[model samples]
Target chain A: MRAFAHTPFGALSIAILRGFVRDRAALFFAVVFPLMFLVLFGALLSNQDQSEIDMITVGDVPLLEDLPADAREAFETTFEVEESDDLDAALAEVRDGDADVVVEQKGDTLVAHYTQTEQVKAAITQSTLKAYVDGANIAASGQPARFGFAAERVEDESLTTIQFFTPGLLGWAIATSAALGAAATLQGWRQTKLLRRLQLAPVSTGTVVGARVAVTIAIALGQTAIFLGLGAATLGLKLTGSWWMSIPLVVVGTLCFMAIGLLAGAIAKSTEGAVNMANFFVLPMAFLSGSFFPLDATPPWLQRVSDVLPLKHLNEGMLDVLVRGQGPSAALVPLTILAAFAVVVTLLAARLFRWDTA
Target chain B: MTAIAAKGLTKRYGDLTAVDALDLTVAAGEFVGVLGPNGAGKTTLLEMLEGLRKPDAGEVSVLGEPAWPRNRALQPRIGVQLQASAFFERLTAREQIHTFAALYRAPGSAADEWLERVGLVAKADTRVEDLSGGQAQRLSIACALVHDPELVFLDEPTAALDPQARRNLWDLLADINDSGRTVVLTTHHMDEAETLCDRVAIVDHGRLLQHDTPAALVAAHAGGGNLEDVFLALTGREYRA
Candidate 1:
């Protein structure tokens, strides 16, 4: 006389899925916000120096000529410093995107004009010219040029900030969405007495928890696809590793965050408390895990601390596969750390879950 | 045979004991009502028997088997309607009930049948959040019964219902009882107990004061007044809210 004709897990998942899809706000945050971040960061970092700043010298700029032949050759190789005698035409070329900066010499001063909107290029050009002038004056004063260093990248291909940031953004988006989403959802279920009611059914708690975790992982997979697809399509994102390696990394990261969310739900007594607790855990991790900037920019001690966090592992592992083009084996350390965190937190969540509000 | 029997059930929360040494027995095919004021541990007691909570002390048997956490065999044999059960917010009433029904492995298309039984067939396609309180209550009841268990537990099923909705639920419960299923419900409404229950158990301060046929309890404790007077006489008039 039972009312159901099949296993409840599928039906239960379908019902729960409708809730996620119908929640327009959650959908927007889970899907659109990450892509939005990608687009915004891509636009900001698009024209950043992939190789070197391009400049044009006009009116026999002595600052450009005063360099030693080898130094001049290196400068021309590092920076596209082309010579043009016509000052007005050089300015026109700079305005028309033929050059990043236009420089001229008048008396003892070296005058430089740059595109107003190209602040990064303008700053680098100004600093480079100033350094050359300082070096020339030192050599003229009967002293070896005091300071000069050539900038070279260790990697074969130069990378933009966006390339470094995309993996972090991907990790952040998936982790926050899965963790906060699970916490809020489970707490709400407990608040409404749904968990209690669910306990009365024939299904085991493991079955229910498994269904939820599976659904979250599935959603996280979709999140990965959207971010990677959008990043590669529009942002010139290149994946050198077995790009498919990101799949396992995202899956493990999803489990890790979901387990953390389950722990939050276990501790929180109410829906609001669950959401607040999730944000409390996730927001700080997002900022510290190099989601918005390079980890190298952070203090050495702070980076060391971040290296132990799950989010940092996720971000770094993803960066290895996506940006660094390293295979899965290259990210073994971080992947193992994330897997361990997932196993530990999932065990804790199972031990502490409260089906009833009491 | 007894459908449910609890021996010296006890539950304590920190310094507060919600249910203290409570004993109860329910027979097969009977309609029983647990009557108590607010905070009388009625929910705690029912939850323990429903296997949703564990009593610090005591043993319980439902359908001749131990009823405790993870009593898998006993689960599908009982149905429960919580006071404020929430459904998936976006699921239509039918889909919500079907989801619950699916858990019990009930026959196909059971949700529509239960929705019809609860007089909610008209709202079957509506999302749970869009339903009125009464409609939602009916939907909750329908979901509880969608599995068609031999025993049913309903906690304050008619608390927020309008008079007409309350009457409809009374009729439904009476019908279920008539069909040879045991029904246990807790309520503050004495009139509901007088009209619907075959037996009423009065409780206060986490202890049972009386359990008997409603009419017999009235005749014995009412001093010639009605059943409500009997309830008031045994359980006092202090606001337990």
Candidate 2:
């Protein structure tokens, strides 16, 4: 009798796994699709030049005048510098896409403001200005060549653009795959009356739901392995710090997204609507969460919004373990948030689930 | 012993009464049919009895066990083939039944036997979506019976089958009944109930008009005509269904 009870759950998981393996759409989203993203973003962001300057100077900016004659001539030739009297208007110009960079001098300190409109150009200006500042500092110090400090990266610091985005892209892919996979599968079962069929067996709704969640998490783990493997082999991704801790985070993150997907399935009346609804919530969350791109330079309000999203925590948690060289302690808060989100959303989904279609 | 006993079974969908104060009972090993047209609440009533839907006010017991609140104890004892159930996607017929058999912890050999019993051995390797409608229905029935439950419920099992396929299914159902496993089936086809059921329950407008053996029902209600004419006389309308 005990055997009778256990087999069904195992069978359900196996059956769901088989169905998922055969589902080309899910395979494309979870594996092939994310691989394409890893390649596309890796190539595009790595080759970008972070040196050309695009700046808007407001009021008296002494940094430009302090540059040596030869360096000032090279700086003036490489960048387009615009002068503005209204600091507020100059900042707005950067915000509104009318301009690329704004260098606001606050007494002795220099503040650079830029927009994501031309993210590549703005990034170049910020780094290039830092280089110019370092040069000026060295010249003023009057130090001999022997006394000058040489720079070296700390042992655990990230080495390249690919390393940072390896986790970022992995986060996005798993989020898409887990959320869309659960929603589509649930809605499809409802539409086809397979849910009703399962109800006839000697299994509780909790058992079926538990099995489904397990299978999704398993697939997500496989996805993480592939992303990490391919990222390291081809994209120069380095795994450091508490990187293995990402395994547990992957499981928890998958639960959170799968819960969201279940909510979409329960709310939408049709399969297509559920898929669209999952996408509607997940796509925006991906960008705000910094899955495809870093949100560090984004405005304060945008970062606050990112804080409210579960995907942000998933990405950020994995980033902490994988690249930031943080310990298991770093994952504690994000894991808690994700687990809590999973519980709340799953309850809501159960409340909204309709048996009529099933 | 009674296989099922349901009393005052009432289910309401807002303003509509899907099943209203219905009473029904099935003796062990008896083949009973619930005959009604589309929108006549046959499927709704069947679902309530199968424990898939909650009743507004009623009591239902399958194999002397409460069917509501989804009694897990009774689940293995009963098999249900829903009106529109689907197979696991992309699975071959053999794999589908094997999966269902595993759910019940039945041996894989039993799954194969059921495939042959349903005459799907030749098409066992075909993917479910590639099977014809009749083959799909037969595979569904085989999957339902793979565990050899004591009782079975089939809803509209032959609704859209061609004449030949329908005839073939009738034989399969007859075999199931001959093996002493009680069967409860709902259908709109008058002849289906009259020919295959030991007792037929005529229903309309969420009410049970009659329940008796076909010969007895005809003699007692219409005194002469076939089941359709008997339906026409009972409800004062042509039995289009």
Best by TM-score: 1
Candidates' chain A TM-scores: 0.75, 0.71
| Residue-wise C-alpha lDDT for candidate 1, range B122-141, written one tens digit per residue | 89899888899999999998
- State fnat for each of the candidate structures: 0.86, 0.70
Candidate 2 chain B: 10-residue stretch with minimal lDDT: B232-241
* Model 2 root-mean-square deviation: 8.9
The C-alpha stretches of model 1 lying farther than 4 A from their native spots are: A1-5, A50-158
Q: Give one digit per residue, the lDDT tens place, for model 1 in A175-232.
A: 9888988898899998888887888889887788877877788889898888888778
What is the TM-score of model 2 when looking only at chain B? 0.95
Candidate 1: residue A94 lDDT (0-100): 82
Give the TM-scores of the predictions, in the order they appear.
Answer: 0.85, 0.82
Computed on C-alpha atoms, the DockQ of candidate 2 is: 0.48
**Clashing residue pairs in candidate 2 (N, C-alpha, C atoms within 3 angstroms):** none
